[model samples]
Target: METVDEVDAPQVRQCPECGATVSVHARFVSWCAACDWNVDPGAPDPDRGRLAAYRKRLARRYGQQLAEEIERSGQEARRVGPDGSTVLAFGVSLLVHSVSGGLLLAAGLLIIGGWHTRILPVFGIVLLIAVATLLPRPGRLPKGAPVLYRADAPRLFELIDEVGAAVGTTGVHAVALDTAHNAWVSTYGIRNRRVMCLGAGLWEVLSPQERVALLGHELGHFANGDVRSSFVMHGALRTLARWYYFLVPHPLDSLLDLCVNTLVFLPRWAVYGLIVLLDGLTLRASQRAEYLADAGAARAGSTVAAVTLMDRLLIGDAVEAHLRRASMTAPEASGGSRGREAREAAERELWERLAARIGSVPESEYERLRRVSARRGHSVDDTHPPTHLRRRCLASAGPHPARVVCDASRTRSIAAELAPARARLARTVIRYNAD
Candidate 1:
């Protein structure tokens, strides 16, 4: 179909279906009302098959490139940093802390020794103040305190272990299930043990094959050593940030804070600037790590299944948002067994509604979403590359083919085991908001 150059003529467009000059909306021109022709000739909407094939190719290429980059990073760390980049970062941090601490100690000792006679009381008070201000406060722990639940699902654990083995990583040591529509593999404890967190909502939407793909992707992070490297960088950066924030005095909350803030501001700012510089330097590598993980997922399952899992996530997120908005308008929960049952029923209804919404989305709509997500690209704050990019990377996944970890019946059984917790969590949301 022919299209219109409405960017230059926003107010009017000649419809392709009918030769009528239809009035345009002046925004993202949806369609001509006169003949219902699509007026906004945006991106080139390629045919579905070609687009899918292109995506697969991109995924494969990205995955290969990522593997190479990760290998190089490991080699580079060994060559340049000796003990590794993370260790070097920590060593530098320790040196900085020690120097600052020593200086503070020296200052206190000199003040007390010099003012031992007449000005001792006043000097002691002054010294105490100096010590308090100069001392670096403990760094704040990472926020977004994850709601961790026991990953007591035996079948789920076995699946994770199998995926980990396939991906060539020391398998996940701990598992947590949370409410969000996401999944990740991370480290915890002094030993830096691996923990995999699965979003219960995400699990509900994924098929058995999709679940394997998802697990593979998470486990892949460990295989690529993304978690371990990031940990060191984060620790160093957090230490600097903590010192910066802590230096700003609190009692007055304004004027005193401002004065202290000024005194420590320049050094703190330098540290922050350094963190930003480091992030900028490492951003591309981090993104590559994500692509490699997706490749790993494609290996565990089929490329199509991996991509489908990502596609469903876009719709699943929308579903969650819709359910939340609906819950806000729900009637207040009465404190009784009957009311509790009613609220629980409403929660269940919302979940069904969510699943239905996801199922109802057209293939064309999904394609459109892929286009938009790809176009948006990755932001500075984003650790993973954009979904479209990841999809493209997986397209080239030839080495990793589909491997079934669980049958349909086993998946259903696993779902049943976790169903009670998810249900309770859903009902809790409804009840909590009712008040």
Candidate 2:
């Protein structure tokens, strides 16, 4: 069978905007090479929504500032320390937790004093509920989440550990796999055990060195001194968000309900304002931490590998769309003994098909994606700075040799270890699309 990158013929077309001749590929965007028309076709404007507009402003203001700073200082930009913004973030966090504690104390006192007055207990119960709603809860992994322990995937764990060491942090306790096209590291449960979550969609497309870059970036979070990720601040942010959720008025059915909602309106907006304020205070520091983490990526996987990883991320939308198309078009088996065998065969082939599809993307397509991203100021999400800025920063940094190298033999071993997860996630994608 012909691969995705193989085109029998190039279709010539005129650019609607510039009247320039363009060469169109079968599976890639066609644009006028001279005029650069349609280079970012159909991409939504990054400055669309209110929150998005705010984030875009932040990205421009801080992203440019940090990029310039990095250009001037080089590796010195990686050293982040307590500043006014971070201190304010911590202060707000303290205030939020204190409010929660006060509510708990008041509820306990009222409940204990209920022996003297029946109404006191009723009010205490209400206060207790409010306290529960306001309290910061530990993060929990979703039920039946696919988790890989060190024992089960020694080679993979070793790679992660080496990356972690390079990034100046201890390795994560566990690895979690999911179906999204992203990767992150978060502390889970009351003990705050660090777990690295890898999305199968993203993982399958990365080269071994890029995978090390990805790991270095994530593990760097623990060492990068992101104030927002600190326990106190993270909990406070969650608590305020929860408060806003509960305080928001529901649909009213009666006059009493209207009155109750009216009373809540101010508090709801107040919590929202606080959330915004806290986010603003920590925004700069967080963006800086991300850049520091990117430096870690370069340190662990070499500058070239890290920069290539960023380039790959620029085409994430294309990758996801390809996967979606594959999922939707996967053949369904007819009911019978033969059907089960056919289904299993298709499941087993899913990863291979996806790998081939992604691997077949040409260098020109990647270059186009980077140009589009630069134009769009694209990012993985609002939390991240623009991809163009990140790419520029990575390129500007001096090249460093890779600290953790995964040879072909170890890479194959790691692949073998992940085979079961690959199979399970492949079936999941197929079943989801079928439904």
Candidate 3:
């Protein structure tokens, strides 16, 4: 099946060997995941036009107004929490904590029984309160808030099958691509189907190969089930984790947590402090995921192509500048200008880091290309890592790519490519966390 990964290949909907949903992800793809019948994109829906095809690759479903609506709707959706998943989780966390607390309470009683050893009572009481306070509670995302998805581009649907087959994956449920040159896969709707977002910004900037590389990385997310798993994980944890990202990253986040819990009178701006913490974590994850996705991208599009895409992302600071402008354009009247400003600043910051990590192209070549993408109107942010670190991982990566081509999803496939390497990578990640 031709998948979302192979952009250069022709889009066909019919199978020559059998009449099935022509697998678009791979050539000679014969089966359809949705309906067992084979279908092909090449067979061409008589209604689709060459012009529509071209524009579809570049335009959005609705203008900015529609996007804002979708953004609005999505926020409400994230908060639904599915019949008290949050409440259930909070209950579970409480139960877990209560049991431990009960044990401590008993210890405290025992200590008090032997008041001669006052140290045990003091320690038990203190630990008991601490665990009880840390217990999870039902958290809410304001009564009404929306989580936004990437722009839905018109042409992104073209890559769905191509990307799927290239990675041996299947099914992109929702079509979304914007007029901008960026393309990404997101999920929305209760159905939990794939929502593809393509920006004119992305189409204008990335080379076809680079686009294919990204598609493969996204499909890796999908075919690998990273997308849905992320959704579920986030859904379950959102309430419990309201204060989590704040506790984790950086030495100071823990301090921030102490102030919030102990003082009991946290200033609103403590949110700003958490933002600072999350900013750092996001930057780190972006850099890390870049290497992983790049590894997958390489398998999707030769190693050389993957490296080149990193170079392209780095050289393309104009993208950052554009996103900065777009963000700035959001009505200042919106509830949170400072938050917007922070996000814009963060994007620029990430784009800059991307340059430092992915360094190999001559400065002169890099500058020239960055300028060119700037001219075309594709905007990128600093979220990507430096190319050098990424390239190094790939260069030193196992000679044989993982058999499953970076499968993070639950697909039955050949033995995972480079099991030892995968295990090492997982351990490396764990140790990094241990730090």
Error of 3 at 424 (Å): 46
In TM-score terms, candidate 2 sits at 0.92
TM-score of each: 0.67, 0.92, 0.37
Q: How far in Å is the alpha carbon of 339 misplaced in model 2?
A: 1.7
Off by over 4 Å in 1: 1-151, 227-231, 247-258, 329-331, 335-338, 378-381, 432-435
Tens digit per residue, CA lDDT, model 3, 258-336: 6655553353235334333333323332333334455556666666556566556543444545444444443333336
- The sequence of per-residue lDDT tens digits that candidate 1 reaches over residues 1-435 is 423333323465676788878654432333554554653345533434532333333444443455455445532111122235444445655655565567566666666676656565566566567556544443222243333233556776677778878777757666666666787766666667677777756766677788889988888778875522565555554555555566544565688677866777777667656545444444445556666677678777667788888786655546577657656755566668876777767776755565554555545456645655554442112355556655654554344467646787777777766666666656644644434
* C-alpha lDDT of all candidate models, in order: 0.59, 0.83, 0.42
Query: What is the RMSD of candidate 1?
Result: 10.3
The stretch of ten residues in a row with the least summed lDDT in candidate 1 is 74-83
lDDT of 2: 0.83
Q: How close to the true structure is residue 317 of candidate 3, measured as C-alpha lDDT? A: 40
Q: Model 2: number of clashes?
A: 0
If the candidates were sorted by their lDDT against the true structure, best first, what order would they fall in?
2, 1, 3
Give every collision pair in model 2: none
What does candidate 2's lDDT look like per residue over 24-110, in tens digits? Answer: 788888876677887877847646556557766776678778988998876525775788888888988899899999999999999
**Error at 404, model 3, angstroms:** 16
